[model samples]
Target: MSERKPVVLVTAADLAPEALALLGGYEIVYAGKTPSDDDIVSLCGQHDPAAIIVRYGKVGAAAMAAAPSLRVISKHGSGTDTIDKTAAAARGIAVRAAAGANAAAVAEHALALMLACAKSVPLLDARMRAGHWDKAVHKSLELHGRTVGLVGLGAIGLRFARMADAMGMNVLGFDPYAKELPSFVQRADLDTLWKQADVISLHCPLTEENRNLLDAKTLARCKRGVIVVNTARGGLIDEAALLEAVRGGQVRAAGLDSFAVEPMLAGHPFQKESGFILSPHIGGVTSDAYVNMGLAAARNVRGVIEAR
Candidate 1:
C-alpha cells in the first residue's frame, strides 16, 4: 500500500486552478472563509493539517496550538506581519514567504501612482466629467528631472529605483540593512534623502523602529512641495502628520496604496484632500502578481510537505 500524502490546509481565499494543480496529488483542505480564533482552533483540532497556506488573515496562538501536526506555513505574499513568526519558530514550524514574486507588479503600481499624482489625472477626469474644461489649471510637473528617494532598497525598492532611473529621475536610496547600493541608485543618509528628494517613495516593512518613521519632524525635513509615494506599510507614515503636511503645502502630493487603517473609513482625510491619489492596496493586485504569488506559495507548501 502507498503512503498517504500529507494534507495542506488553505486558510485564505481559494487559489487559482493552476496554483492548485501545481500541488500534484497532495490532499487539499480549503477552510471556507476566515474562521474566528475559536472556530479555527476547533476546526484544526479535528482536521490537523500538515501545512497551512495563509493570506489576509491572522493565524493566532489558539489556532497554532490546535494544529500539532502543522510543520510549515507558506504565506501567500512577502509581508509576514500578520503571522506570528516568533511563536511559529518556537513551535518548530518553518515559515516561508513568496518574497520576489510580486516585486515587479508592485513597482509598476508605484510608478503608476506617481504618474497619476504628477499629472493630477483623477482630478482632471473628475472635472471633465462634471462639464468643466478647466484647461487653465496650470501645468503639472515632469518627472524627468526629479530626484526620487527610496526607503528600503529591497526587491520592490530596487525595482522602483530602476524604473525611476529609466525615466531620467535621479534615484537615491536609504537602507541601513543593505550591504551595498545598486549601480543605478545613489546611497544617502536618511536625513539627506529626506531633505533632498523631490519625490519620496517608501518600500519598507512595518516594525517598531520604522513605525511612524515619517512623523512631523521628518516631514519638516522634506523639501517643500515634495511628492510622496507609499506602496509599503501604512504605519511607516504618520497619517495625521501626512494630512497636516499636505494641508500646509509641505507635501505637494501623495500617492498612497496602503493606509494606517485599511479599507479606509468613509470621510477619511485622503478622500477630502486635493492632490492625493489613493488606491485600495492594489499595488500587488495585478493578474501577473496574483499568479506569481499564488504559484510560488503553492510550490513552497508542496516542497515542504514532500520533504517532510
Candidate 2:
C-alpha cells in the first residue's frame, strides 16, 4: 500500500503556481480570507494538516493543539510576530521565517513613503484637485546631503541604507546584533542616531524590549522638524504621541505603512493630517515579492518535514 500524502494548510490561496509546484508531493488545503480564531482551529481539526503556511492570520496555542500531525509552521514573510513561538516550542513544532525573501520590495516601499512625506505629495494632490494652484507653501525638502538613521540593521534596513547612500545621503545604522558595518554606512548609538538624523526610519521587529520605542520622550530627542518613517511594525510607535508631535510641529512629517491597529478606523485623527502619509500595509505584497516569499516558505516546510 502506498503512503498517503501529507496535508499542508495554506492561508494564502493566491500563491503562484511556481510556489505551489515546490510542494507537489503534499496534499494542499486552502483557507479562505480573514480566517478567525475558530476558523483556523476548525481547519486544523478537520484537515489534520502536517504543516501550515500562515500568510496574514494569527496562530495561537489552541489552533496548534488541534492538529495532531503538525510538525512545522512557516511564515510567508519576514515577520514571525503572528505565530505563538512559546506554544510552538512547547509542542515541539519547528517555526521558520522567509528572511530577505521580500527585502527589496519592503525597502522600496519605505523609500517611497519617505519621499512622499518629504515632498508633501498627499497634501499637494488634495489642494490641486480642489482647483488651487498652491505652490506657495514650498514645504518639500531635498534628500541630498542629509543624514538618515536606520533602526535595526536587518536585511530591509541594510537595503534602504544602500539606496539612501547612493542618493548622496549619509546613512547611520543601529543594530546590536550586527556583526560588522557595511560600507557607506556608519554606526551610531540610539541616542546619537535619533538626535543627529534629519530622517529616521524603522525597519526593526516589535518585541517587548522596544515596543513604542518612538514615544513622546524619543520624539523629543529628535531634531526639530524631523521626518519619521516606519515600514516595520506598527507597535513600534505610539500613535497618540505621533499625532501630538505632528500637531506641535516637532515632527515635520510621518510616513506609516502599519498601525497600532490594522484597518485603521476612518475616524482616526491622522486622516485629517497632511503631514502624515499612510499606506494599507502593502510593503511586501508586490508580484515579485509574493512569489519569492511563497517559495521561501515552501522550502522551509520541506526542510522541516524532511529532517524529521
Best by TM-score: 2
lDDT by residue for model 2 over 1-308, one digit each (tens)? 98999999987566667779999999998888677768888999999899999996788899899998999999999998889999999999999999999999999999999898888888888888998887775658999999999998999999999999999999988999998878898999999998999999999988989999999999999999999999999999999999999999999999999999887888899989877999989999999998999999999999999884
- As a whole number from 0 to 100, the lDDT of residue 65 in candidate 2 is 95
- After TM-score superposition, the amount by which residue 302's alpha carbon in candidate 1 deviates from its true location, in angstroms, is 2.4
Would you give me the overall lDDT of model 2? 0.92
lDDT for model 1 = 0.86
Candidate number of the best lDDT: 2
lDDT of 1 by residue, 87-129 (tens): 8989998889989889998999999989988888988888899
TM-score for each predicted model, relative to the true structure: 0.93, 0.97
lDDT of 2 at 236: 96
Local error of candidate 1 at residue 169 (angstroms): 0.3
For model 2, the run of ten residues with the poorest summed lDDT:
10-19
CA error at residue 100 for candidate 2, angstroms:
0.4
Cα deviation of 186, candidate 2, in Å: 0.8
